[model samples]
Target: MKAFRLEELEAQRAANQGAYLQFLRERNMSVGLYALDAGQADPQQPHGQDEVYFVVSGRASVTVGDETETVARGSVVYVPAGVVHRFHHITEDLKVLVVFSPPES
Candidate 1:
């Protein structure tokens, strides 16, 4: 079993681009913590594997292809493999738990 604390991970914001702390990695899947400050843009591209985003705190507008939705704490969003998606109009500091299947490379 593995354990993680968000507060500890948040303190490791070593870059202005937000903090991406990967905590769990297995043969079939991986999990990570992503924290982005308000007004910051997400610099991510489409992934080769399916992914799920579990919002741990804060709020944001997430765009998956042509559809956009407001997400907050406890919200879960899914993006299929190779889909275009991004977070914008961040109204609050966004802290999310990211899960990727097939273990992203």
Candidate 2:
């Protein structure tokens, strides 16, 4: 089993963008915890793999295609392959559980 402390992961943010914490990665999937600070939005791009997002803490507004939804703790969102989606308005340091099938990276 592998374990990663949140504090340790938080210290390794991707230098090119907003902060992120990757906890695990394997051949077919990737799992991680992410934090989106208030007013932050990652670039939107279409991916060839399925993506699932579960709001672990705080709140966020997610846009998928022409639809947008407010997701908070316990809320879940799915993005199928090729869907154009992005996250935003991450108030209060939103924490999210992210899973990607056929891991992009």
Candidate 3:
């Protein structure tokens, strides 16, 4: 069995960005805690794999194609493969938990 603490993961680097913390990864899945500074925009594009985003704190304006959703703490977003999505307008220091399936290569 393996256990992880969010505080520990906060010290690691994932994409050279300042707003994301990857807490765990195993098999083809991963869990990441994200910290979005105010005015930050989460990059968007098509992915070969599907992913889920769960809001842990603050608010986010998420866009998936022509549709947009306002997410807050305790909210969740599910993104399918090949869909274009992004998180934006991080008014507060947004914290999000993301899970990826069939991990990217």
Among these predictions, the greatest TM-score belongs to 1
Question: For each candidate, what is the lDDT?
Answer: 0.89, 0.79, 0.77
Give a tens-digit lDDT track for model 1, residues 1-105: 577777766666444344687778999999888887899999989999999999999999999989999999999999999999999999999999999998889
Clashes of each: 0, 0, 0
lDDT of 1 at 24: 82
Lowest lDDT block of 10, candidate 2: 12-21
Q: Estimate each model's TM-score.
A: 0.90, 0.78, 0.82
Clashing pairs in 2: none
lDDT of 2 by residue, 1-105 (tens): 888765566666545355556678899998877777777777658878898998877887899887999999999999998998988877767877788898767
TM-score of 3: 0.82
Local distance difference test, candidate 2: 0.79
Q: What is the lDDT of residue 40 in candidate 1?
A: 90
Ranking by lDDT: 1, 2, 3
User: Candidate 3 on 1-105: residue-level lDDT in tens?
Assistant: 878765566556445566666667778887777777779767657777788988878887998777999999889889998898888887887778888887654
Weakest lDDT window of 10 consecutive positions for candidate 3: 6-15
Ten residues in sequence with the least summed lDDT for candidate 1: 9-18
* Residue 101, model 2: Cα distance from true site in angstroms: 0.3
Error of 3 at 76 (Å): 1.0
